[model samples]
Target: MHDRFARSEWFRNDRFGLFMHWGAYAVPARGEWVRSYEHIGTDDYQQYVDAFRPDSFDADAWADAAARAGMKYAVLTAKHHDGFCLFDSELTDYSTMHNGFGVDVVAEFLRAFRARGIRVGLYYSLVDWHHPDFPVAGDPYHPDRDKPTAEGIDGHEPDFDRYLDYLHGQVRELCTNYGDLDLLWFDFSYGDLKGEAWRATELVRMVRELQPNVLIDNRLEGSGGEKGSIITAHPSEYAGDFASPEQVIPVRGLADETGEPIPWEACITLNNHWGYHAFDHDWKPAKLVVRTLVECVSKGGNLLLNVGPDARGRFPEKAVEILREVGDWLADNGESVYGAGAAELPKPEWGRYTERDGTIYAHVLEERVGPVALDEIDQESIASVRLVRDGAALGMAKAWMAEGNPGLALVPIGPDEAFSYPLPDPVDTVLAITRRSAPEG
Candidate 1:
């Protein structure tokens, strides 16, 4: 195991977390990338900065929602690609403190989440569009990228070194001011702007010096679309502590060249956008969210589900409802997720498998016609089988119907040897299977 993996032991065990994408973009309610996507100039975008006051913003409420949803940790956007800082930074006047929103959003978030015993993390964007030194012309995802010169956006003679200093300074502030961050989520790296372009080694060294135990994402060397050198045998100094796969889950969890499992977390949005989009009502149901969380754990990965709060600084009613429903399911079946990882057994046709210690949790996503087949599991090795929701014991025996299949370990759905259609929990009916103890020498 890599030295960093030891530091990420807690992270690996934390199967689910909340990713908050709240920022000035929330004011527009279009999306987090509204400025760049709409090609809105800084002068036009200033409207959001001026109107950015989340009167109903309650950090405690946010933390409460996260806690109720079974989230063990959370990551909030301290600064996004638009160059707006949610915290009070002495180095820049373009922060929440200077923009009439007197509250230090980052500080409140940290205090509230920490009070609730949830590990806190901050997301800082490497690409700053509002900074004059940050090149705009010819830069993809920049509002003024199509302009003639790199300085066309702000025309300040583009000094990238100056921008680097500011970037490093802000990071230093975050590390110093925040009590103790559990993680630091960097936005991305693309084209020629990776690794040394951000002086990643020095930055990582500073972060480590300030907060030794904090976990970092691989975006300093790669983006959400790329896994970076962390997956290789020899990773760079800034290869990060874990691979962050965004928007989509990996078919199989991340692994190195040696086929050994590596730490990873999938960041997925609840709706179509990371920031609140009033028009995008296409929300993922609680069932899909629950199954996705199970899938990630079954593949030896964590899920950092996103919640984009609206401009009013409130979680959407639908989002809250879905989270509550997911929390309800977890309230009963959390044992199958928390501290669980990929089981030694193969993925079942009916559902997924997650194991911890001698216990294997079978997540029955689909209903079986007969008795639920425990494929590849030997009947002799089984110690006990019981429903995770309730401690009700489930009988394990070879049914008369399965006379031809002698090797298959079958567990009845209820009292009888046959399955009762429409599972008690349709989303995920978890069954805890305990392995028999080994014989003494």
Candidate 2:
């Protein structure tokens, strides 16, 4: 473990990451919540464990796919809420080492991804349904919630404190046994169990000691607990490096209590589910995927696009195809996105803006009326404008002047003039505008 670890420049500059949701749940070809949604008890759920043999699971292939898609980092589920461990943990018998796989998936993930120069993160669910010490009957997402299993029927009592010790021990193993990890993403916290209830302070201290730069997420809180505002140094009793907003991107990037900006990442699925769902063919198109990445960067946030590997431990063909197309788009227009953040200007009606060093990438996602209106910027300040992909300098002029308007780029409304300045295709085609050196006040 590298004690000098912390969220470094790599995370902030990369702006995009890959999230993988895999476990025994993928064996069912259902979503990650297969057990809880179906209310299947431990005995019935063990069928997946018995059948779990991912002969086609190639960590290198997975890493290559991520690198192709221009993902700089990736996070894999080391253990899900179902409590199946992908790693060979000495403390747990129910791990990939003993389960049918008989392989350390986490080790493979680290070795393969690192080979491609991609940083790795591990996702560990705090709520373990399989652990006997975990309150199976009381926890809402537990498979045996409100129902008695063999242990409950035999008059066994659940000791949550013991579970905490096990959880902390497993975390220690993750931090120590493996090499430096970029992130230790905890799944969630909810209800009264939020925050300090998990003895997060002690756990965080231990993690920092093990790997000083390991970035922890907000979910260390109990189920349904708050992931607090990133504006504050310590959102709760525990301090984390960033905010994790799942499913939906924030309307605007988060701001702290005092109105300072907060670093955040939007974790979204490529389709309807996070884990393999055989019938979840309702996938998002590559166009939308690329735009979403640009959108996150535009809002001063990161996008963690997810991929749910199938039962054979390979990405579905559809997902692979989508990623390939996205890779192509990124290859051409990556300059506008990588290392860029919110331009701090008003949201453009046409699309969005991402700022980096001395340039602004104007992403046109929608068709806005007439010449591009750079809402608040002065027309005189733009030194040059070039189509991001084609590399052609576009001519500009002060087309209209209004009460509060300094000026907007002028373009002819006629058909023939359209040929002079053509729009970039693929929806999120970006225009790289170089700002002139600002005049001294």
Candidate 3:
């Protein structure tokens, strides 16, 4: 049941998924953390709720864009730290249904993604800024945390256990209503709010009962600072199914104390903001996006790349275009990226390498003006080598025994002069190396 037990093979094989950060905060177009960042009191923030109108939301387009980008699964922010539920929650009045959207957005997300044969996941936040029973006292993430609840215009005495009922009730609704969920990505638990505070054991048990096969994340470790580690407190019972790293990829594939690699996913954003912001234009290009995906595979991890749809519930055109280009790259070079894991070989100076079925995929990233060295790759083990970009084979003339190295192979570009390209391909060219023969004894 725990992480040490087993993992879904599909998760290991898929390796790429989409993360959508959308909610009522998107209406502000500031960012997902606008509530805390701006420190606006509850009454002021109600303006967004009153004005929430996303008439242009097209679920099919979102799912199609993700599928086209070679993403096998998607996770949406069913409810963010703001406590705005995108689904129709009967337990609470503060939801998309009350916003007059007259629709259950989560249901829409499920229908579209499921129709395209993509797995579904839901993101729920443990911190609720809008929930009354949830305390604002001493809560760093809360805008009114510093101020006394008695002084706030929209303030009330908070009860800890009452909030738990609401939290558990909402979670049960998500698990029971969603036909089949692949993942439940919880936002996090910070100081003073750890495992027992949320009654995680009972909550997780409920989730398992609802969807036996769905995988859970390790944020339940209650160690908010420990992002890349999913070690459960207990051994036999399952807590979270996987480790989740936010914003950046791990230096090395995340490993346990014993150096055994732990299953993890790098949840990164396409731009500076996770939610739609009309002003934040620091969008990462498509080339960087594809390269990041390859880097994840090489590091033996998955990439949960993010996209923030505007308040209209539509993905920005730039994000769509970037994902389309990434899809094109995956269409051609997926053999080197999908279903691949960390290679036994060390990282080449030129680029990274990923392995699949004993075959090596050398991702040539930089321009090799002279020669590329395969440091420890024995030449005899190479059955054949060809460029994935254009199935052109490379022979012994191109690769041969290195002069000084014992078992290395040097891929020479020219006899006396180096061959250069006017411009390197925007995307990395993968060199697929197949086994020629068994390694010599």
Q: Best TM-score goes to which candidate?
A: 1
Q: What is the C-alpha lDDT of each candidate?
A: 0.91, 0.80, 0.81
lDDT of 1 by residue, 410-439 (tens): 987866775466687999999999988989
Residue ranges of candidate 2 with Cα displaced over 4 Å:
1-8, 148-154, 222-225, 368-370, 398-406, 411-422
lDDT of 3 by residue, 117-209 (tens): 999999999888888888776677787766655332265678879989999999999999878899898868878787777888888899999
Considering TM-score, which of the candidate structures 1 and 2 is the better prediction for this target? Answer: 1
Q: Rank the candidates by TM-score, best first.
A: 1, 3, 2
Of candidate 1, the 10-residue stretch with the lowest lDDT total is: 147-156
lDDT of 2 at 326: 92
Which lDDT value does model 2 have at 388? 75
lDDT of 3 at 236: 25
User: In candidate 2, what are the lDDT values of residues 1-441, reduced to their tens digit?
Assistant: 112213555676898899999988988888999988998877898889888888899999999999999998999999998899999887788988897678999999999999999989999988787888887655677777757453452356888898999999999999999999998898778766667778988988999899987777767653222446445543554546767888878888876776666667889999999999999999999999898888888887889999999888999999999999999888888988888888978888778989998798888776545455566677777888787787877666444333355465543222433333335574576788888886789
What are the per-model numbers of colliding residue pairs?
Answer: 0, 12, 2
Model 1: residues with Cα > 4 Å off, grouped in runs: 148-150
lDDT of model 2, residue 392: 71
Error of 2 at 306 (Å): 0.9
